[model samples]
Target: MAGVWRQELSSLQAGTQNSILIGIIIHSGNPKIFEPTNPRYGFGGERAVWSFTFRDSPDDFINVTVWGSTEYINSCFKSFQVGSVVEIINSKVLSRRPDDSRDMFVPTVTSPLQITVNEGNALIQFHDSEGRAHYQPLLKMPTKTMDSLRSLNYVLQNIEELRDQFIDLLVVVTFIGEVRDIISRDGRSFKCRTFEVADASTEKTISLQLWDNEWIRLSELWEPRKTVLFLADARVGYDNFKKKTIVSIARKTLITENPSVQQALDMRLAIRNRPELSPSDPYSLPSPKNITNVMTVQQITQKLNAGSTGTDERVQFFAILYASITELNLDSKDANLLLTKCALCKRMVQKDRDSCMNLDCPSGNGSREPYNLVTFNVKLNLKDDTGYLVGCRLIGKAAEQIFGCTATEFQTMKAEQRMELKWKFLLSKFDVRMQVLGPTASITRAIYNILHMSRFETAEDISFDDIIDPMRNH
Candidate 1:
């Protein structure tokens, strides 16, 4: 007989028996059916694995994976959804070993422990009203203000920035184009929808995409310029064919109409003042128009020296990719040095014994699991015939694009590979555009944020200079 075992999720260990755990479900995956290879099992059977990120405290959650027979999945867990409290009794803990795989984007649990429900011995039950009442205070802790939500972090990021990294986002939309159904090469048809969104932090309009059922539902409510949409938990990733960033919704994403939050209302006002719709076509998002005031490297340096340019001004310019810097060659005194960021909040976090040390962070407070994400800052030197700018930073998506891989992938490369990559970028030339964040007492203190980077292409149809110069004239 299994001995009595009851412990908090934080104390769960392998080999525990007659265990009991209770927490709310955060994410669940579809069940799969498979045939057992052993001759003893003659027929095919089904099993499903679901992930539960539960917490007794409202501030944080501990992720638990539960896998069991189809009968248990359908009868006991099928009704479970995010926010549902569940009680799991009589399970075994199986510790997962560290994986050294290259795909960092794939979700990996840092917690070594996982619980398996023993078929006949385990029992699973949903909490009734009285049971749920105990958790109500924790659950009813005031919903975070929109400003405090994680989605606000990426709202200001431009399309180019969004494309450079794999990130989940929250965005507010001011305009939505009509929906269209498109056929794929496999002769299958799917619905595609495109929309335009803008935020107070940026003047440029961002294009957004939704598909199939999401499009069908959103299309009915979506209005051109009239409807304001608050989209949460959408993913931002690159589109290979289009060579740009795209935002798509996932199952857990929240879509709401007429966003009344202060931040959304402020962004809507910003959009109304400078209303411009990006090309509605899903495949086409044009590059930023070249302004006549495009400054040269000399002009930018002189302006920085004089402290004449407004900090808020987003200036466009052209410069050559003159050099690249590695961590080995970095000056010890550089203020904008690289540091690791929290995956959820993008805030600098200190690593504790195993997990991150930001007690206020949900990941930090919820579970003892180590952080799966860490990022480094990359710097490039820009120059022209007139002057040069040293240590120009390329962060997040820009840095990822420059390396031609994700930050996680770059971090895993060998020392020699990383050194070789530095030289490769040093050989390339490009037109660089950036926004000036004003100068401090020293020229080195001035900050420039990369807005876009394009290769120096010289083709028969249209040369890079030909396309850029004409736009400048307009």
Candidate 2:
């Protein structure tokens, strides 16, 4: 390392030799193993490869790729995570080609040249010397300037004009959905997670899908409403199933969470006054405009059974269920009907404690007090003429809206008052808006979440028999 001259990424040229480059890893991808096409290539064995994005300055970042044995690549991948400052010694610098297949997955960077590190010719290790702290802060700096950023409201308003185009966005994380395993038709499997983000310009939120394993793992650290993301070159497209424009992490996209930019600071300040939702409930209630889809009990069952994602139907749809609550479980003595969860970690907490005790949570790391949110986790049985759906969830804010009271208010009520409130829902037919999460490997039963519910009157002239008769006749 002594013989190598230190080189900044902006000064890196294709012919540079015996140079050292220092940067913080901003995006770490999962390691992949590939078999050599020819018998002479890689000695007919599988070779391991890993790729990541690193930056040393505000406007200078490059894609760094490592090629070696499976053990070597895996070890390197595990050794350094996204925020680690690394010193690369003697890495081969080469100009990026337009037709390079590896470029399809690598994020577009400010630097035109790419760093390639092989086992023998190059080395990448953690920077342990003085001034390494300077590189670490670069991890949160936006790759693109604020001038290029677009508001979520603008993108939504002009989605038709900008379809299939990529744009930079600065948004606050509003929701993070569950991570799921996906298997393609070709038998390859990977992980994906969907989350929603919003900006100050709009109250509407947009969902973005994370397909990279590294990003999916990193998203676990993102806190709803508190995390700010600066997504560079995020692809915008229309979701046919949901009938809305959506954002996704594309090959050209580089995400910097909690970016140290003025836009990020302003976006966080804009959202600071908004009331917080339960961390356990990431999916919000569908607006009246989106709750137009109508589905019967049998149709919902058929949709779950015909799902292509194994037993799970990963796509969520909102539908109107004109059913009555058969079971409310209000009179039961079970202790779990109401759940107390830590807002930061989203883990269940003891009913007696006000703070989170989860040792793994960052906010609960003894530096600050963790916030707790009391939520209703009651289950209800719903039924119509076609069939019955059991164990449907009525949780968090949605449950409070339907029950006409807060969890704290309900806690103070007597058993007689609780039964009276339960009867109000049980005896009356209601129009219900629900989100459906079909069964998966981890969850054996389909999850039905009642988003909104309102009582129906006989004078309204809507009848369940009238709705079912047409389907039965057809």
Candidate 3:
């Protein structure tokens, strides 16, 4: 626990992390010594602590007073050599002489009780700008196992087939197991361990379950002496009881080594600084109650501002990086991988993929090919102001078909041409946000879309073959 004087004395100190300092040393030649005590430091009138600081270094070097019981010092204990380090806890600097009328020029230490001697410097290690305490990112990763998890998200999130096949994308996995957790056909409880993953794209805690075969091979390369988790891929699904999904990873997800810290840092920076992102206020993270389908972007923006900017940095602090689960929805690797413009090559390519689709792309493999494309729909909406916010929904070629664009036309497009295509799609969404069509048409679609009640858009009154799902976003 911090002492009661911690806060008050800290205000007089130069920084937020440490307390005030004082010294007792004096220069050999210049007898004049003065250190004025600010009124806030407890001395209301003329009082000061005198000491000759080692000013030769140009970097801050203090001359603090040697503090101890009176029995510890001599009659002229006031004089001491510079650079003599000493410890003084729960002490304050003040004017040495209050009653003296003349020689108002000189100042000296009032009372200092040295706690210890031969003291070295002390550094404050905590970053408390937010309500929570934070440390520098320099701490070596706590685990020794090297797992490879790159930020392929900027490129991977744009994966059309992978996105369509999986309900959610899970990236970055870690676990404590050193051996495989194998479950055989005979229902034997052999261990074939799996890596656990959590991310923002879905609220689900996903994992990559290695089969006995992959686990065996992985065990060979994985040094059993120390525990290390390698990042890998997995297919996710709920268990028989449907409590939570376990990822079936042996099939598709690769088993790789651990990612380096530089990779993580780069991935984090990429996601944080992604172009066309909403700069959410770090102080204002929303609660579950605050999230609603009916909530406008403006309202969300307002709620975010009103949210707690944590004290001691426990709450909100880093603008792009919120430590919360939702804030960490996307993986760092995902951010680095998803922004890729080359759908075919999967290279760290340009920002505009449509340009590649149109021109003779070095990495192009035609638009209709399985790994050839990735597209997103930009939903533009107006809140209090006109068209102030945009939401992103990923889509595929089928969505373009719904928009009446042919494959040939979409493939041969320049950057502006593709943006124009997206812009047109957003314009249509703008009409929807504005409720462009009058009451009847709007009611017809809204009734069908929300309640799944209308016959015009759905086969509500007609066929039993109607998809029971609310909507297929892609």
Poorest stretch of ten by lDDT in candidate 1: 322-331
Instruction: Spell out the clash pairs found in candidate 1.
Output: 61-366
Per-residue alpha-carbon lDDT of model 1 for 1-474, expressed as tens digits?
266565766777787777777665543433444445565533356555544445555444444555556676555545665457777778767765556341232232334566666456676677664676565444333222364343433544454565434333334554444344454432345666566665555555566666534234435655444555555445566677667666655443444455545655565565565533434452332222221235556556655555445454332323232221222222233334345665544456654433355676555575534443455565667755455676666666555665687767765677677767666655355556565445433432666555456655442233223222212332
Give the winner by lDDT.
2
Residue lDDT tens for model 3, 1-474: 354233322223422333423322212111222233444544233332222321111122222333222323221133333222222333334332345542122221122211112112331122223422121111122112224232233324443333313222313332222233332322234544444443323323333444443244444443211222333333344456436433454332333233344544443333332222111222121211211223233333433344434332221111110010111111122333123334433333445444344334343434333233344222322222211332222223323434455434444566566555544433122211111111132232111001100112221233222322212211
Better of 1 and 3 by lDDT: 1
Query: Candidate 1, 23: how far from true, in Å?
Result: 1.7
The sequence of per-residue lDDT tens digits that candidate 2 reaches over residues 368-431 is 5656667898888988767998999888777887888999898888999998888887857788
What are the root-mean-square deviations of the candidates from the true structure over C-alphas? Answer: 19.1, 17.2, 29.3
Stretches of candidate 2 above 4 Å error? 98-104, 238-245, 276-474
Computed on alpha carbons, the lDDT of every model, listed in order, comes to: 0.51, 0.78, 0.29
Give model 1's TM-score versus the native structure.
Answer: 0.40
Predicted structure 1: lDDT: 0.51
TM-score top scorer: 2
